[model samples]
Target: MSELRRFLEQLTAAPSAEALWDLHCSKMAEYGFDRIIYGFSHYMSETSMGDPEDFILLTNHDPSYMELFIGNGLYRDAPMVRWALHNVGACSWRFLWDEMARGALTEREKQIIAINQRHNVTAGYSISFKAITSRSKGAIALTAREGMTQAEADEIWAEHGSDIVLMNNVAHLKIVTLPHQSTGRSLTKRQREALEWVGDGKTTQDIAMLMGLTSATVEKHLRLARESLSVETTAQAVLKAAFQNQMFIVDGIQG
Candidate 1:
């Protein structure tokens, strides 16, 4: 069997988000993209990508770079990020260079470029996945190793861009199917059970009887789920949990 086929099979069967990410990172590294940043949101809007806490973010970029780029909100002004938000398919970094050469970048965008250059994140490509929902968006940036020029990255893309986009699309689809809760947003088993029941249109009393708990206990679990998800209502909790793939999960695959 071909190596790509083997990798796709492994990717399809990956048991957890972390395992899928590890496989993807190694594969991209072989194509000269040693640093990667992937982000997806199911709750995007006209003005926002929803709360940062709710995003499914995977990256192997340096923590310091990520801190300022994402943590500090510099990505909002990043030229590539703006392009990813507005377009789909693979884009070469030369697009950014061209924009800079034409003096079209805003001051904030220039600052983002400056930081990226300092961290050797100068050469790469971005792939914007087709949105699965009207409000959903997903994109990834693949950064070449230090010292590689945009010309070199473009050459690699010219040869392997189609395969790289296919692999990333598959990985993104698999990741969305897996649970991806943030640290403080994880629900207890009971909370998850309660929310799943709620998603199935169960009343509090019905969930209590099904789970062998009192109605008040079920209510408490449902309440805690809302709190954990930082949502206001039980229905919202159910929706959020489902969005994160954290409800009705298979027993062994709970990650």
Candidate 2:
């Protein structure tokens, strides 16, 4: 009966990522963070962020700012992002300033700091969720509204850091359940179930038994899944489906 539980119920009911993100932005705004960028990569490794198209990046910053930050590769040099990549949990931006004070930041990181300052994104914290796998990373950058000082933002975090972290964590957990739709990529009900079973390490015979179908029908579904996902093999199809957050979706039941 708590307000937080009701909000979470609404969040989990949001049928689309866009709808959920709007709710998130509003909630964070109530807590002094007026801007946020949340990005998730399910297929990243040390070598690459994987395909640019597979990333689930949601933000409420000005279009021009995002255009420059992502289009110009400024995120590569963002100190908060770097910190999140290496560590988990929330931390205030004071650490970035501390790094700057100690003369440890690279020129690129300093430039990003200046950009953030100019754009009224001068104070906030970054919370990086624990990596569920070596190949996945998800994090959020929350920027305090204009006029809030670093000290004030730090004070807010000191008082409410655990609450903020819990909310963002719930947001991420709800996000992976919503379907991701993209150009020329979608899976049928059967295709999704087949891929889910494969990702669960089931063979064609196992999937057929579970789905009450012949092995040949399961193989057909797997082949179609591979074609729909633009992958070459069943394994690749399963990985691609998971990366796109398409497998194990609720109500994936076939008609």
lDDT of 2 by residue, 22-141 (tens): 999999998899999998888777877666556778899999999888777788778998898899998899898899999999998999989988888899999998887888898999
Alpha carbon lDDT at 66, candidate 1: 91
Off by over 4 Å in 2: 182-184, 188-234, 248-255
Top candidate when judged by lDDT against the true structure:
1
Candidate 2: which pairs clash? none
Give one digit per residue, the lDDT tens place, for model 1 in 101-205: 999999889988998888888999999999999999999999999999999999999898999999999998898999878644678888998888888888888
Clashing pairs in 1: none
Clashes of 1: 0
Worst 10 residues of 2 by lDDT: 246-255
Best by TM-score: 1
lDDT of model 2, residue 133: 81
Model 1 / residue 220 / CA error / Å? 1.1
